[model samples]
Target: MNYTLHQLQVFVKVVQTQSITKAAEELFLTQPGVSIQLKNFQDQFDIPLTEVIGRQLYVTDFGKEIAELANEILDKVQAIDYRTAAFKGILSGRLKISSASTGKYVMPYFLSDFLKEHPGVDLTIDVTNKSKVIQSLENNEVDFGLVSVLPDRLKVDEELLVVNKLYLVGNKDHMPKTAKETKEIFNQVPMIYREQGSATRLIMESFFERTKIKVKKKMELTSNEAVKQAVIAGLGYSIMPLIGIRNEIYNGELQIVPVAGFPIMSDWRLIWLKNKKLSPLAVNYLEYVRTHKADIINKSFSWIDLAQKAHKH
Candidate 1:
């Protein structure tokens, strides 16, 4: 029927306290006003809401069911109001993000700068393997992700962020002199590799497949940092994003080896659900990345080159 929210509100309040006077006090209305509103509510529904049993109000089964619906409607209204205010830029909110392990090295720098500019926005960053990041995005657990290798199915929409070249990185002392030397060293050394579902591992694998050569792996780890550490400790060499290993290579802790017949690289993407609703703030963040996409890629590779030179004897 045609019932107003005010009537539902009064009915809910009276049912909650089981006392007209108490409901009126809570609602800042006189007892008679609450009683009148409750009567109008019941009249609209063609049902009796409560019966007086020795001055105590007891709700009917129908009344309880209707009150449940009322509560749900009120909750939805409140949520709408909150979202409306956020859209107006009056309320601040947090955006949850997930990213592949390699992103941990560069994504945070970009986020920190963004947060500095938008003090009203909050952020939560989850750094994990590429597979987990994609899984989280698909499960609707995170608003966005920075991923290395995306699914071929293209179930999500992605913004091109950067182009990254893969490098066979290792400790400076164990650096290879040429592509042949690199392959020989790879065959001899204990090669640390990323776990399955890793974009870095996939890139390396595809390169090997193209060249008709298989490089044996000595260890498999989930953490990109762990792989970097192992390589620095002379355990083995591994493929990694140039941006990620810049510092170590520049500091003479790691060396970059060019593989023969392989110059494989992948595009970094900022991804989100194709069908999910994006908040205004989330859209703003994506736009910011698009504006600086080229700069970000150039900066990443620039560091790689400088780091490679520093590692030279």
Candidate 2:
């Protein structure tokens, strides 16, 4: 019972990461330091919080319970800190965000103004696949999560930030210039595909399913940049978000295929757990995004028009 908040924080990190080494690296503590704290924490309760099997960390049922309670305690502490800082008219705290990999192209525009306005805030942004982003949000590991696909299983509050429009793109010489020709060509040409679990890939698959077209996937790449490069090399076509490919399209390295049912639109959303109480800093950020989302999204995508003009000239 005589445990410090730091111990609880470390324990929660350990549970979330499932690695003492990873937890230490995240907390900026030595690996042995984290191990000692975790041991002391378990000794206080006289119950094993975690077990290691085959070099993998597993949280016991008791550990899971404690970790949930630790999260609650930490959330409340953060709320209190936020309240105090609000009273002083000074916003200062950490803002942790986990975003789907594709969100990297858009989130910086949304955050750039906020970060400049709140100079005292410490910010951390983690970009990963959509599944991991949702996992982080479910565990309350981040203040907010940015993704295009909303999870159905988790109860969350979400705000639609922008529309992510995906386009079928390929080398200009190879892609057909009209929707009819592109549709006819789609079944014959090999396509570069985003790796499984990508939001873009999922959307593309749904489009193909609806259109009843069987695509010949030539390569599966893990990142957007890789997919673009493969397409540039004449490997195949890919469905890519316009936000991520404006530069390439403008530079004449790639062009959007005017395929039927092209430009699949998906909603990009900012989400957090519905029942969890947000700190003042978090609330401020959420409110700012809600109020200025239109402007932020407009500015973020203004390049699309410019890119088109550049391509024309």
Q: Which candidate is the best by lDDT?
A: 2
Task: Name the regions of candidate 1 deviating beyond 4 angstroms.
Answer: 1-88, 176-185, 294-301, 305-313
- The alpha-carbon lDDT assigned to residue 243 of candidate 2 equals 81
Q: Kindly list the per-residue Cα lDDT of model 1 for residues 223-283, writing each as its tens digit.
A: 7888989998988888778778777866889876755533357777788989889987788
TM-score of candidate 1 on Cα atoms, chains taken together: 0.66
Please tell me which predicted candidate would have the highest TM-score against the true structure. Answer: 2
Give per-residue lDDT, candidate 1, residue 285.
Answer: 86
lDDT of 2 at 185: 72
Report, for every candidate in turn, its global Cα lDDT versus the true structure: 0.78, 0.85
Error of 1 at 6 (Å): 31
Global fold similarity of model 2 (TM-score): 0.72
